[model samples]
Target: MKKDIDIPEVKNVHVAVVQEKHLEYKTIDWNAYIINNSDTDLETVLIVSQGKSETKITPPMRHTIAKLPARSYAKIEFLQEKVLELNNTFKVTFFEGNKMFDKTYVFRKNTINEKALQTLPLMQLRGVLVK
Candidate 1:
């Protein structure tokens, strides 16, 4: 039987876009936030990309949940290329372990604006701010 899924509320804190050679890797910071956007716990992670070339830097790993406390913060870094494959569009997936949450984001090497941000929410979010 299919079981119900419990997804936590996660808010993206910051994102760093790096351009190396002809490849671009985006590092995103994610943390648990209150439903009312009040306070957050201090729990974070540093997720780096496996790399851009066909040779993956690291195998796909599971992301642990950030039990963000109010007034605290959690940092999560993610490689955009992993979720959004080359030439592909935005994508969303369920992240499990420590906490259950959904990862909604996009991978693109273009301008950052309303048009780009608009595509973010479609993945189930208000909008993802790209830098």
Candidate 2:
């Protein structure tokens, strides 16, 4: 058997906010800070981050796969908005509680002319710490 290492497993999950600069032909790096920990088992942790819209907030248009330990970042690309185009803007709000967690990461995508790389990899997630 292989030796196991120790790391802080996430229990709760939430997006601090949605952030984007360009919403047109260009691409931008987006990150959803997932607050989580191990449920019962120390080794197994569940982190769920999905893109959807509700009465309170509008979800992301296009996003990569959900949470992954090794790859903790995602990209938001714009194809076309039938009714309402992004035009570089997004928003989030505090919604009710559920099995996952009661948290929100409001975001707006900004218009970017050219392609640019994100400066920071994983920035500190700040907001009301939902416990």
Candidate 3:
């Protein structure tokens, strides 16, 4: 017989975009992170970018996390050429204890103050997942 499963709340996870500087070329790089803060372990975690204009900025990048232990984070590095502007949204999906959960995070060009770009390893955006 089939059984009902509980759907995990989006709040259990966290996501962030980080900006890093290249030491050799002195250029900027962007990366995404999925942090699992809940008590359950996440399986088949997938991070995908959405929106037309957004894909142009970064060519439809996707990252997968086979398993994300609770209280840990998985990083997805953006290795493409730097673009002057970025306005995009990312969706993160994963399963916890037979329950599925997903959330999207939107980012505008000004999400991170332009001035802050001067600093290395800066967190461009950060927030808890929400439905």
Evaluate all candidate structures by whole-model CA lDDT and list the values in order. Answer: 0.34, 0.31, 0.62
Highest TM-score, which number? 3
TM-score of 2: 0.25
Models, CA RMSD each: 9.6, 12.3, 5.5
What is model 2's C-alpha RMSD?
Answer: 12.3
Give stretches of model 1 more than 4 Å off: 9-38, 42-98, 112-131
Selected candidate, larger lDDT, 1 vs 3 = 3
Provide the global lDDT of candidate 1 against the true structure: 0.34
- The sequence of per-residue lDDT tens digits that candidate 3 reaches over residues 1-131 is 23555455587576655566768889876555666767778999998874335356456778888999877777765534243256656788888877788778765554543454332222234332222
TM-score of each: 0.31, 0.25, 0.66
Candidate 1 lDDT by residue in tens digits, 1-131? 23676566655433323222223435342221112123333344323222232543344333443444443323234334443333212222323246544343334433322344432311234333431
Model 2 per-residue lDDT at 11: 36
Worst 10 residues of 2 by lDDT: 90-99
Model 1's C-alpha root-mean-square deviation from the true structure amounts to: 9.6
Q: Which ten residues in a row have the lowest lDDT in candidate 1?
A: 29-38
Query: 2 or 3, which is superior by lDDT?
Result: 3
